[model samples]
Target: MIFLLSILTILNYNSNSIEINNAWVRPAGKGMNSALYFELKNSSANSDELFKVSSNAAELVQLHKTVNKNGLMEMKEIKSLKINGNQTIKFAPGGYHVMLIKLKKDLKTGNKIGFKFYFKKAGIIKADAVVKSY
Candidate 1:
């Protein structure tokens, strides 16, 4: 009975938690910088904002969004991202992405990099980004 109660309490405590996954640094060739993609899930009762992103492998990191302008693909800066309660937001290619400017090192396939996420409500979350050829 005690263990069951403890489990319930823990679950309740974490009911408003947020999580991130599948973050990776895109593969790069000579003179080519990289971008990052990931998924953000928020189970909180309120929404959250992803204000900033940072990584050690890149000299600068910022949020970017892809838009169709005059039937052409264009990328622009995103000031923030909204995460509704009990919802997930995905950052992928041809959509919202993390722009990795000024490469510090080469990202090879099977390599993993560390990234830090800045959230308005959830504060900071860190995750390991894997390098893949996807």
Candidate 2:
């Protein structure tokens, strides 16, 4: 039946083609800066680029990379992060991460922060990152 076929298609599309796992944000004290880390997996046979990220808890959310410059660590804002088809990208400390700029409030452990990741091909993926104390 047409209805049955449509439902099946939708289910297949949502069946973890692109998934987020182990998402967490570092707890920041009074500082207005924070970082979020997660693992992104792309199971579909199409490459996608994460272009945008937004969060209500921060004034600005941007993709960033940590680079060592002159034996010093620096954070640089990047435009987008690419994830090839069937590839997994890890966003972790000392690597690629989401920079939460000008946080509205201090991040505390056991709290949840909502974020929306926009992909070029696969569309938008919403995730809640739990705040963790380091």
Candidate 3:
């Protein structure tokens, strides 16, 4: 029952709402840049766009994607990402990610970092991403 509940919690959101699930940040040394990965779900009837991401733990925050070009994997900044209604977008390794640059301090494993994400229609969402080695 607990597993079902957890799954439901991750999957379900009210109308015109957004939620983050399994949010995690990579562990890195002080002053080093790290990345965050998560699943963003939209349960709205209308499409939503992610415009900006911010965090106090890093000097700069950006949305990035790892693309394969000429057999080389390169990270590129993405200005915005649109999430269709009832869609779930995965920000995983080797794919779309949140880039946290110039860390204010070392992100130790098992710690949670707070972030504020701005959306075009959903407004600002505050999330806490856990730090992990993976």
Candidate 4:
């Protein structure tokens, strides 16, 4: 009975997982820079921290946020972002986004790119983003 309860607990924890949706990457040429946007939803009862992001599409993948400093807009790199329980974070334009620096190759329209998101509790969450010209 103890073993059965343990199994059920693990299953329930997995069911309440983080969800990534509407992931998309901007089109860019080789050696150029691009950005990725997505919506991250945390459904678990506990809050999570997103610490790192990685991708093979670019040489460097970093978390960044657009800020308006002294009436000038600038992009700044952030160490980590916290997602509250049952909350949704939108990584869109003029907000938090993933910077894809030094592209390995041309990302044309409809091309797909894979990324890995490192979290504190949910572990590594893999997501795919389509190349688009938004």
Candidate 5:
């Protein structure tokens, strides 16, 4: 019955909410760039759209997608990311991610950054991005 109760507890959360897990930011190397990764579990029983992402450490932030064109991988902006009912979408390196633009400072290991995720249904969620190696 605990499993069923767990289900109910999750469902009882905000109707437009998402559970974010493994939230992290990449440690800066020679470059001033960093990437944020997370797993977003949609338990709202409906679709949701991720509209924007932002952090105080960057001048600009955008939802990015890695596309391979002729074996060359390039990053591009994604206006809206869709999440299906009761599904988890992972944002990680070598795949879709949140691009932190124009670093304010170098992100070192053990450091952390705070981010806000804005969505159509969920409104906003504040999460910490823990720095770690790739």
Candidate 6:
């Protein structure tokens, strides 16, 4: 499926060996919340940890995960995420995702938002996510 392929691409790289693919953000109005999804691929022999995420488009950007708590879906903030060497991590709906809180401006369809991913080993990896609607 297309969704599976997109996830594969995201897990495909940060530095020379870590690549990000199929990065995107959900469209939202100013002062509203949005979410970013992507695939992070680690191709190096060494493992890496994504400790932080930053984006000027929102007042606050944090790593989050959706969980089923007592049959109710809840979103929780996560401190960090790890991706082993030669592995891939997918940030998707109902899973691990980036929470964009309090948008500074409207994220319309086709708009691009800049992001910086902080990794323990890879350092800061800059990426742009396209605003889209599912």
* Alpha carbon lDDT at 107, candidate 4: 95
Using TM-score as the measure, which candidate wins? 4
Off by over 4 Å in 2: 1-15
Candidate 3 structure quality by residue, lDDT tens digits, 18-49: 99889999999889999999999997666889
| Candidate 5 steric clashes | 0
Prediction 2 TM-score vs. true: 0.85
- Cα deviation of 63, candidate 6, in Å: 0.1
Global lDDT scores for all candidate models? 0.84, 0.88, 0.91, 0.92, 0.84, 0.92
lDDT of 1 by residue, 1-134 (tens): 99999786556644237798788778875346789999888977677789999988887888999999999999999999888888999999889999988788788999888988898767788899999997
Q: What does candidate 5's lDDT look like per residue over 59-97, in tens digits? A: 778899898899999999899899988999999888889
TM-score (all chains, Cα) for each model? 0.84, 0.85, 0.87, 0.89, 0.84, 0.88
Residues 1-134, candidate 4: write the lDDT tens digits: 99999887667665247988999999999999999999999988778899999999999999999998999999999999999989999999888999999999999999999999999777889999999998
> What shift in Å separates residue 15 of candidate 1 from its native position after superposition?
10
- Looking at model 5, residue 68 earns an lDDT score of 87
- Candidate 2 per-residue lDDT over residues 39-116, each given as its tens digit: 999998767789888998888889999999999999899999888879999999998999998889888999999999
User: Comparing 1 and 2 by lDDT, which wins?
Assistant: 2
Each model's backbone clash number: 0, 0, 0, 0, 0, 10
Query: Please, what are the lDDT tens digits per residue for candidate 6 over residues 1-134?
Result: 99999776556633778788899999999999999999999988778999899999999999999998999999999999989989999999999999999999999999999999999877899999999997
